[model samples]
Target: MSFRESVATATVSRSVHFFPLHLRRDLVRQAAEDLDRYHGKAAADYWRSTCRGLAADLTAKGCSDDEMREQIMDFQAAVQVALLEMHREQLAQG
Candidate 1:
């Protein structure tokens, strides 16, 4: 499936659901902005490492692969939306 399709169908993981909604939104927004600051391979590398780190962290906290998968998918969708909004705002300001 396409990234957009996957994102559109993404669900919040139970593990991540423990976090308050505001905190989750803040984390995703900050991560999205950080990822968007990079160019070319740097961006790809950052995203890969971020996902790996997230998986590792969740695993350490005793989360299952299914939970990790959902969290990752949810995170990806949130970041993509955040980045799109950022770009839209930038264009509007210019």
Candidate 2:
């Protein structure tokens, strides 16, 4: 399956029942933003590692892979927005 598909599936299966939908989305978005901030290939590796860790944790708690992915996506999105805001602030300061 494609990466997005896998993530979506994992999210649905693992996390949907635990968190409210909006919170889950926010968590995944934050994770994505953090992953994007790293230098070079490290960013990709960080995201992969983070996702794997999250998946494992969720599974241990009886969550499905789909839920884990969803949470990560939410975190990523939140991070992205925060990063953008920080950049803007920095620009304003300069």
Candidate 3:
């Protein structure tokens, strides 16, 4: 099934909601770092796509537009912070 289709059917997937809050946050950060490593210059585009997907999912789950926007902003900030920390570590190691 397509991502949108799946999200539309389930309020939250087990893969996501199964985890504790802290673990889920760590997973998000780790995913951002991994995507940056894999996508390099295209990582920003990928991240934006991820946030868009989040918005879609939130909408599917009946979130208000304002709630979706706030969540997306928070998600983007977390990803940016993760990427920045990884970059700083790489620089420090050089």
Regions of candidate 3 where Cα sits further than 4 Å from its true position: 1-23, 38-41
TM-score of each: 0.74, 0.55, 0.60
Q: Name model 1 segments beyond 4 Å from true.
A: 1-17, 20-23
**Candidate 2 per-residue C-alpha lDDT over 1-94 given as tens digits, one digit per residue, 9 for 90 to 100:** 9999999998877633565323565555566467657977898788678767866776787766777678666655666676677678779999
In model 2, the runs with Cα more than 4 Å from the true position are 1-37
Cα lDDT tens digits, model 1, 32-80, are 8999999899999999998889878877877778877877877888889
CA lDDT of 10 in candidate 2?
87
RMSD of 2: 11.6
Report the number of the highest-TM-score candidate. 1
Give the clashing pairs for model 1: none
**Number of clashes in every candidate structure?**
0, 37, 0
TM-score of decoy 2: 0.55
Query: Where is model 2 poorest over a 10-residue stretch in terms of lDDT?
Result: 14-23
lDDT of 2 at 30: 66
Of 1 and 3, the candidate ahead on TM-score is 1
